[model samples]
Target: MIRVAIDAMGGDLGPRIAFQATQKILAAFADVEVRFYFDPQHFTVPEGASSNRFTSVSCSEHVASTESVDRALFKRCDATIFRALTDLAGEQVDVVVTFGNTAAMVALTRYIVGLLRPKLYPALIREMRPAPLKCLVDLGANVHCPADMLTGFALLGSAYLEARSDDAANVALLNVGVETSKGSSVIKDCYQMLSARSWPAFSGFAEGFELFDGGKNVIVCDGMVGNAVLKASEGLFAFLLSQLSQHSMDTTAVEKLVRAENRHGACLVGVKGNLVKGHGRSDEKAMVGAIEYGIDIARTNLSKKIEQKLIQQGVL
Candidate 1:
């Protein structure tokens, strides 16, 4: 059975959305179990959430988005978010899902379960496009990273895609231009290193305009650039979709941006355990989507595969 620990005190809705979503998930999956952690003083289990597969644990605090990482780590260490992750670290659960403060979740998970060899922190992975599917790494995890760290991100991104398919992805660095001298020193250094590597079919560079052009399967970059690119794409798509309401423009692509799948959260790759961070304003559907994604990730055993791949590539 796959067990998932959820930080019920997370997101904007607190335990309400978490509890309701848990009920939806329990109704859909038979072999899954959930453990919800919440602030006992403010949260109560919602109706229809009572089931043998569900477990509720009371926590003393909730990590707020505005809270500093240090404060959350030291003062609110016993917060529902941390408690849920602690359960994951102890092997009591298969995965941990949260809509809590992104910084807190990342910091605590790294401090607790530790990084998966060579990773300074986890990289968030998200799917891109309608037909020729691909994954984008480091969506917003590390704003600034070194060359070698970017290399590790590439390896983690490759392993994630490899777990789902046999085809080797054509990886490319996201940059201002395809020219080698276009980006900053860090990006140029990363480009040089990736170009020298043999694995993952390094496909050179990709610009923002070429994200969905179907030339590259995986795009790699520092979190600063990657986050900007992702948010811009999401925003642009939302804008275009809103304008074409009367003309019957296909909103499938735009829907993919607004849908629960991407909004649910991004996986914190490079960690020993499965950890997903939902959007801060995640609703019931987004919460359920995150848990469902966690279940799929558990079945994939993604972290183990990532470790083995890193070791095999001598990157570990």
Candidate 2:
């Protein structure tokens, strides 16, 4: 059975959404088990969440979305996210899913679970739409990455896609212009480093407009830029949908498509264990989607595959 550990109190909606999601997942998948970590003093699990496959652990503290990583590490060691990562490190669960502070989660994961490649840091990768196979790496995990870490993101993103499919991933650096000389010095250095690699298909720099063109399987960038791109895309989607409604166009089909596209959560790649981070404002449906994403990653043995790839490529 696949075991999933959840930080029930991580998101903005509190533990209610997590409990509801757990109930839905338990009802749908018979072979899955879930362990929820939350503060019993602040919230209570729903009656319907009781199942042999379900377990609850009490955690008195939780890191807020605005909490700094250092403060969380030193002050709130008993937070739900920390406890969940501890369980994951101890082999109590196959994977961890949280919608808490991204910075805190990244820090705590490195502190508790450690990295697969000691020299490399973890990056958040998420599949994008219009081209479902396309993915963007470093979605707000590391705000400032040097050239080496940027190349590492490429490796992590490529290996992640390769694990899910038979084809070799086509990687690209996200930049303002497609021209090789266009980005900052750091990006140019990353481009040079990636160009030296012979395994994965390294397409040259990709402009933001090329994201949905289905040309590159993986787009690499620093966390700050990637996070901005993601938020802009989401905002644009919402604005366009609203405009379509104002025009008296039927938006039902578009809404369905958006929902389907938004199902998968971001994966914190390069870590020793699987950790999926959902949006902080996730509702029950999105929370369930994140858990399902974690289950899929767990089943794929993604971390093991990444390790093998790193060894074969001599990345470490």
Q: Candidate 1 on 1-316: residue-level lDDT in tens?
A: 8999988776887778788898889889999998989887887776665678998887878888787666537556678877888788899999998888877787888878889874445889877652455788888788779988887788888887776566577888888888887888888888888888888789788887666676687888888777778778767865878888668777777676556335346789998898887877888987888888889888777788877877787777
- Index of the highest-lDDT prediction: 2
**What C-alpha lDDT do the candidate models reach, one value each?**
0.80, 0.86
- Local distance difference test, candidate 2: 0.86
- Which stretches of candidate 1 lie above 4 Å from their native place? 246-263
lDDT, residue 65, candidate 1: 76
What's the lDDT for candidate 1?
Answer: 0.80
Clashing residue pairs found in predicted model 2:
none
lDDT of 2 by residue, 183-299 (tens): 899999999998988967899899888777766889999999999999899889889999999999999998988887774579998988999999988889889899999998898
